[model samples]
Target: MKFYGIVVFLAFAAFAQGVPHNGRTKRSISDNLETLVESIQALASEVNEDLGIPAFDPFTDDSVAISINQTLAKLEGELTDLNIDGLSDFSIDTLKFTLIGLKFTFAFTWPNITFSTGYSIDGTVASILPIYGDGKASGEITNLAVSGTVAISVKNSYLYLKSMSSAVSLDDLDIQLSGLLNNDDASALIAAVISDTVPQILVDFQDVISDTVNTAVTEYVDDYLGSMTLAELLALIGS
Candidate 1:
């Protein structure tokens, strides 16, 4: 969600400074903003089709379990070697852990889930930056609320239940460390513990992640489309 917020900010920033440069045709700000709105609506639609129908399950065939371990191993190494400046009581050098093996069980019906509407986006004018590209052009997005109704009945859905091995990637991770513990080396300990534990935890919880993402995407899309600022058009990405 934080990442999404950042993306929204970037999109708006680009809109503000957008010009007919790089061989692109000129478009008014309103046109660009409307495009952004349409993109979101399209997102909702795609989420409904892809996730709602179970047409795309990254972990469906046990592929996730097998692939995630290697990524976890690399993360363990990187965190172990990470160097943080001004570290008096903590060092991110001691981080280490082995990823836990994972398995999944699913009883998915034809339409494993249903989304009644897609997500909604709203922000106060006050949250927008009066000036662009200066400081905090990362303008705040206010009232960015998302609401939807998702129905998931995997338990009642008659289908196959299975588990598999999988692997996940952790790319370009920007790690940050903070906090102090009673004049002690808490930060180092915390980083070490996290580096050791997070991978295993993620591997163990892959199934939950899959189901939650699926439900959230579809429900938000279904609920949001009804009130979308733009009408549904062709697919946003691949058609």
Candidate 2:
């Protein structure tokens, strides 16, 4: 999910800055931000390909790790050797950006997103259910919304992401885990419990997600912007 957000953010950022390419019209700096965003959205595919931004539809990760802590379910464990897929097929219901000083707030909603993963978890569910196995997990989230504030800083005329804070919420979620337990009923029950609890868990651990996004985005954006000279950047935007 974080990776998906990062790609989308960078794609818009690149388009807004008017990264130059062959046969593309240069955008004037005097154009309003709203107009620029509209153009970006319309030309998203073209710009993403031209700028070499990672595709947002159908994103995948070969390996990931997540810690599970659910007091209500009495679940405490870790998911390792996890492979995640299907982050790209989403509809952007809304995307708004507000800029003030060196800070900007970005709000967006993905109407629907479906994903699947393979994982191995060692945990205890419902206090009595021992969950230790390798399995496949699949789910869909409805109305996933995110709002974030980003602070930018300049050093040696290069822009860097100084900090970021974000909040995430979803209207609904459904998940299923298979091959975790020998009994089908038990596995289905566990899956139901997870589906119900995950939304709240995301809210509880939002800070961790924000910190991770900040670190990763800052490094990537800083490196990318630093590679270009101020003059080159300005030129791209027709300044």
Candidate 3:
């Protein structure tokens, strides 16, 4: 759920002037943006290492807990001592930029994102299914897309992100929670229900997710932008 790749892209765009440039013909802004995108696509691992961002091919987090209660489905569960991995294994399908004056909008799609987590769930899955055990949960989201628009303004002769908005969507989701029930049949049934319901749950919480992403992205991007003057940013881009 962390758009760490996007953050890296923006960081590069803002500070690419530091990158050594070869003597070549002056390129248009669109061409420069394209180059930046290519650089990210080609050197994401190296760039992430340089920036101290952990590689996501299989990022691991040990401190995760979740409590789930769905009244309509008569399901209640709590997953504790969760360990999650593979949060960063995603491939970018497309990255498009639209620039108009000081406003920039980025539309991007991650075609494949997969993760696995191990936890202990203690609760009932359905009214009759007893979901109590240690288990592993895996999921994959396809064609996950996000579009964000950021408006930049100059304040006291420094660039800052003035306002931001974002949208999120996905093509499909598949989830499998296993080893939670004694009966294999019951476990499969619960996993099927989860796979069917998760997309809807995400839809219901789309606004919340967008808000969280917007706030986080704005704060992170602004910190870097604020430190540089408009002239400095322009010089970096031109370089």
Candidate 4:
């Protein structure tokens, strides 16, 4: 769990996976799941606010729009001269999305037991080349996916991720849960276990996108300008 306050990606389950906690104690499986997921979402919002270079503000903050637009325009120009092949043409329209922050939007569809969430770079333009960058440093990555499913035990709270490509069955779950009982940090660990079990693709997308979005925010925010050119530094140094 990357806990830097906000702008993060997290997915988990709340069940005991088969462990038997006859009576309730600190929290139920549902309680634990809610906490873990909520905390992660809170972290994303926090990071975005802390580090994200504000995009054009629809909310009365015109200064925000000007600053980021100038910043992204310069960055887009820099990358264009870099001769980086496969990059689309640099334009304010394109850079506008770069200037905009990818929102931490999430929704849970209970009936299917599928946790579906995605980051969208919201802007006035159509979606394309949605890289998380600021006016400073920018990077890109691919293959982002996110997904998780649940299996409830006969007892209600005992839960697990059905790793099977098809729907996970009851027998497969019981065998796994028996040993997990009496374990430490069992609730969190159990959630991670199911989370980790998520296929590489899903995990990769979730993680890569989170990083990409954060990197872009950091790049734009001027906080992580550790890589500014020596000449750029020297100019500041002589001052």
Candidate number achieving the greatest TM-score relative to the actual structure: 3
lDDT per prediction? 0.27, 0.61, 0.61, 0.25
TM-score of each: 0.28, 0.66, 0.67, 0.18
Q: What are the runs in model 4 whose C-alpha is more than 4 Å off?
A: 1-9, 12-25, 48-107, 110-239
Error of 1 at 79 (Å): 22
Residue range with the least summed lDDT across 10 consecutive positions in model 4: 90-99
Cα error, residue 95 of model 3, in Å, equals: 5.6
Q: Model 4, 1-239: lDDT tens per residue?
A: 11111122112111111223336455443443344444333333222343332221111111212112322221111111111111111111110001012111222321111111111122221233232322221122222222222121111322222111111111111001211223334534543554444344333444443444444433332322233342332232221
Q: Counting only residues 3 or more apart in sequence or on different chains, how many pairs clash (N, Cα, C under 3 Å) in candidate 2?
A: 3
Query: Candidate 2's residue-wise lDDT over 13-104, tens digit each?
Result: 65446634434566435343335445544543343655555544355566665555544333333444343343433444434433344565
Backbone clashes in candidate 1 total: 23
TM-score ranking from best candidate downward: 3, 2, 1, 4
User: What's the C-alpha lDDT at position 167 in model 3?
Assistant: 80
Where is model 3 more than 4 Å wrong at Cα? 1-10, 17-26, 47-54, 62-101, 119-134, 179-190, 200-204
Candidate 2 local accuracy as lDDT?
0.61
Each model's Cα RMSD:
21.4, 5.6, 5.4, 25.0
By TM-score, how accurate is candidate 2?
0.66
